[model samples]
Target: MSLQQQFEQAVTDSKALPERPDNMTLLKIYALYKQGASGDVTGERPGMMDFVARAKFDAWAELKGTAQETAMQSYIDLINSLKG
Candidate 1:
């Protein structure tokens, strides 16, 4: 399957894992998915007062300059690990 398709499928499968993921794992999934789909962060960072938004933005920002294919592969690998 195409990498993007595989990424999408991994996202779906991740939600079906036997055990729930911790908050950090969820955040990593969110960040990697965003990076893989959109490539790097965009717009302004969320204000520090907005913890959730700030966290998401920060997580995505950390992946700045990462290649889309790399992000997708990383996301897929993480999902597979979580599944097992």
Candidate 2:
């Protein structure tokens, strides 16, 4: 399957989880997955977890004030666009 197909599958699968993920976690996971899938290894950057990644996750969580389905959908849309 194409990357776009994979992303679409991921989006559908993620949404089917019994417990929805926090929006920020979903966003960060989306970012990491995109970077990894593209061979950027940005997700593997040294200190990414301690510095930027964690911060972004925290910020998203705070900004949403709760898990936001829209944020997850946005992440899915981003991946779809990237794959296009």
Candidate 3:
């Protein structure tokens, strides 16, 4: 299979991670997932009261310059590192 297919499979399998990762790692996973799936952040930022949404949005925004393929590969690498 191709690298992107492997990466996509890894992303699907990531849902089975034995334990939840730390905040930073979770943010990274979320950001990379969004980047890989959606390309870039869109729409307005969430309100302050919506902290979780805001954080996710910010995380994705940070990865604005990352290429989709790069983000997918990074996401797979991160899941492997943490799962091991």
Candidate 4:
């Protein structure tokens, strides 16, 4: 299958993981998904008070400069791992 097709399937599969991933894994998933679908992080980081948003933004920012295809593949791999 095409990389994009795999990525799209992974996106759907992510929602049905047998168990929820840990916080850090979830962060990685979010970051990879964002980088894959939207390319690099954008807009202002959330303020300190918005802890969850800030953490998510930070996680995504950490992937700065990652290519979209690479991120998509990473996301797909992660989702598959979670599925198992």
lDDT of each model, Cα atoms only?
Answer: 0.92, 0.50, 0.89, 0.98
Best by TM-score: 4
Residues 3-83, model 1: lDDT tens digits: 989999998998799898988888899899999999989999888799999989988998899998999999999999998
Query: Residue by residue across 1-84, what tens digits does model 4's lDDT show?
Result: 999999999999999999999999999999999999999999999998999999999999999999999999999999998999
Highest lDDT, which number?
4
lDDT of 2 by residue, 1-84 (tens): 654555567666655655555665556765544443342222333355476666654444343322234444455665444443
RMSD of each: 1.0, 12.3, 1.0, 0.5
Instruction: Give, for candidate 2, the lowest lDDT window spanning 10 residues.
Output: 36-45
Best-to-worst lDDT order: 4, 1, 3, 2
Model 3 segments more than 4 A misplaced = none
lDDT by residue (tens digit), candidate 3, 1-84: 877887888887789888989998899899999998889999999999999999999999999988998988898888888777
lDDT for residue 31 in candidate 1, whole number 0-100:
90
TM-score versus the correct structure, for each prediction: 0.92, 0.34, 0.92, 0.98
**Backbone collision tally, model 4:** 0
The residue-level lDDT of candidate 1 at 68 comes to 88
Model 2 misplacement above 4 A: 1-8, 11-49
TM-score of 3: 0.92
